[model samples]
Target: MDSEVAREQALDAAEKLFYGRGVQAVGMDAVRTASGLSLKRLYQLFPAKEELVVAYLERRDLRWRGRIAEHVERHDDPQERIPAVFDWLEEWFGEADFRGCAWINSYGELGATSERVVAQVRAHKRAFRDYLAGLVTDAGLADVLAGQLFLLAEGAMVTAGITGSAEPAAEAREAARSLSRAN
Candidate 1:
């Protein structure tokens, strides 16, 4: 297989295994098997499991944020766009393979042991918050409201992940509505 194709396959397998299971639980051999890449090729693509995990996270971050952006941008109203984010989350939480936030899961498992993992997690979170900040600004809401919404969304993700229900997204959306009004 072409190196880029092999790399994408490896990352796809890594995202599935790492997100569904945990970073530490899934081994590189499993990734190789899933990707149908030879061990040598897998190692050639990802020198270490950490490299694979980071690559998986980086790719996931783009896709995840892109999905949210697509959903939110569907709204013509900037104010409506804010709540649309929760709508996206609710849909995502309802997925059969719904696992918690990949970044959060990775951070919980490997943050202390791996600086690179920690960096990926932090960068993902910061980007998420910044995205919220942009939405809040565009909606003419106070800057502080962005932080409040960010916390609400983050809390909702954790709750939905743990309870395996989409209820938290609805709950968070209501709270966000109330908060937006207050602002």
Candidate 2:
């Protein structure tokens, strides 16, 4: 396979392994086996597992945010759009391989020891918060409202991940609605 296809195959395997099993739990050999790539090829593409982890996180962040943006854009009203984020979360939580926020999970697993992982997770979260901030601004709400919404959404992700239920999304949406009105 060419570099692009090889890279994608490697990332696909890495995402499944890293997100399904904690990042530290799986080794490059597992990714190599899963991707059907030789050790030489895997090392050539990734150089290091840390590099592969960064790539995995970057790809996942892009896809996750893109999906949420698509879901939110289905509504024209800002009020409706904000809640649509939770609606998206609810759907995501119900997925067969859902394992909470990948960034959060990666951070919990390796943030302290791995600078690349830490930076990737922080960037992902900052971007998410910024997305909510834009929504809050569009809704004509105070700037602080975005932070509150971010907290609610993150809390829901954690809760849903732990409890293996999507109910937290709805619960967070309700709390977010109350925050919207109070602001």
lDDT of 1: 0.94
lDDT tens digits by residue: candidate 2, 1-183: 899999999999999999999899999999999999998999999999999999999999999999999999999999888889999999999999899989999999887899999999999999999999999999998999999999999999999999999999999998998998998
- Cα lDDT of model 1 by residue, 43-67, tens digit: 9999999999889999999999999
Give the alpha-carbon lDDT of every model: 0.94, 0.94
What local lDDT score does residue 45 receive in model 1, on the 0 to 100 scale? 90
Q: Estimate each model's TM-score.
A: 0.99, 0.98
Q: Provide the lowest-lDDT 10-residue window in model 1.
A: 12-21
Task: Please report how far candidate 1 places residue 152 from its true position, in Å.
Answer: 0.4
